[model samples]
Structures are given as structure tokens and as C-alpha cells.
Target: MKFPRRRRDPVEVNLTPLIDVVFLLLIFFMVSTTFETRQALELELPESAAGTALEASPVTLVVTERGRYRLGERELGAAELGEALSAEADQARLHGLVVEADARAVHADVVRALDQAGALGVRQVRIATRETQATSTQAETP
Candidate 1:
């Protein structure tokens, strides 16, 4: 009797399951992640009775008690504020402006900065303020 040789089978890899798992992970990250726009500088804003938070990031203009105006951290005079804002607008896609005025600063100064921002084509403008803290650090001092 003659013995016959057995044929060998070829090996193969299935990638359907691996591709499905990768797509599931991508969808999970896209749905669960939140993105925030942070300002370059930290600021201590004054309190206000009618202050609201914005959903989008805005260019910040800080007005000190000494009547100095600043765009982010750079100080600008009234005459140059518009030019500075325009220069910044060239680099930004969405334009919004927020004026953070000190409690002791004059209202006219804040208005002037808003006007300058508007002149630079910033359609959305807002004023910045801090929420009142409930901690009793001499609440009756004022």
C-alpha cells in the first residue's frame, strides 16, 4: 500500500474586529471630550450685579485703576488701541472683545475701549466681572 502526503493550509489574519475597535474608540473620544479656550494672562475681575459668562473666547482688554488700558498684557494708549486691536484681528478667525474694568476705573474709559474694539470689527463685546464670594471676610467692611 502507498502512503499519501497531507497538504498544508496557509495562515491568514482578519482585521475587521481591529478596525471596529479603533472606530469605537475614536467615537468615544469625539463625544466625551470638552474643549476650552484659555486666556494668556490671569486676571482678578471686579464684581458686578449684571455680569454673564460667555460661551466663546473673546479678546480681553483690562483697564487698571490708574486709567491705563491694556490688551491682554500689553498696555496701549487711546490713540493706538484701535491699531493694536486691528493687528490682532488679522491673526484671529473669530473676533470678540471683552473689557475688564477695575471697580475704581471710570466708566468712560471702559466705553472708549469698547468703541475701539468695535472699530476694529469686533462684533461681539462684553464686560468682565467676578462673582460675589459668600465667605465672611468682613462682609460688613464696605
Candidate 2:
């Protein structure tokens, strides 16, 4: 009598563990990444009765008491401010300017800076202001 022939089993690759590891790596990278630090130019902003905080970061332009202007930390004149802002706009994809003027700076000077930003195709202009302080005398009286 002839012996029964044996059959060979087919080979297969298991991908479940591979796919799980790939997903874990994706999550690890997402959680491990850090955001870039934003640069700001500090100034003593003028007080206002209706000052509000902005929801997003803006490109800052500081005006000092001596009629000096600066973008970030670089000092610029009226003519140079436009060029500097334009360069920043190109780099940061900014469409507006946030003017931080000192309380002692003239109002017309601030307006002129805003006008220059407008001429450079910056459609939106925001003036930075500090919230008005409530005096103790006023609070006690009322």
C-alpha cells in the first residue's frame, strides 16, 4: 500500500504589530515637538478706556518719545519703517501692524506711522493700549 502524501503550509507575514508601532511613532513625534518662540519689543503703552487684548500675535512697531521708531529691536525712520515692515510681512506673512506708542509720544506721530503702514499695503492697524487704572479715590467716592 502507498503512503499518504504530506501537504506544505503556506507562509504569511503578520502586519498588525508593524502598523501599531508606526502609529505609536506618529503620536510620539506629535507630542514631542515644540513650538517656536515669538519675539516681542516691549514698550510702555498708553492707557485707554476701551483697550482690548488681541487673540493672535501681531508684528510690533514701537514709537518712543524722541520720535524714534523700531521694528522688533532695529531702529528705523519713517522711510525705513516701511521697508522694514515690508520685509517682515514677506517673512512672517503679516497683513497688519500693531503700533505700541508711549504715552508721551504725540498722537500725530502715531497716526503718521499708521498711515505709512497703510501705504505699504497693510490694511489692518491696531494701536496697543493699557487698561485704564481705577483710582482708589474714585472707587471710594462711588
C-alpha lDDT values of all predictions:
0.72, 0.75
Off by over 4 Å in 2: 1-42, 90-95, 139-142
Worst window of 10 by summed lDDT in candidate 1: 35-44
TM-score of each predicted structure versus truth: 0.55, 0.60
Query: Candidate 1: what lDDT?
Result: 0.72
Backbone clashes in model 1: 0
lDDT of 2 by residue, 9-90 (tens): 8888999999999999999999999753223434577888887788544577889777778777589877687778777775
Q: Single out the weakest 10-residue window by summed lDDT for candidate 2.
A: 34-43
Tens-digit lDDT string for candidate 1 (1-142): 9989888788789899999999999999999997542354344578866767775455677887667777755787778777777877743327566677887887787888777766666777777788877667755755
Candidate 1, pairs of clashing residues: none
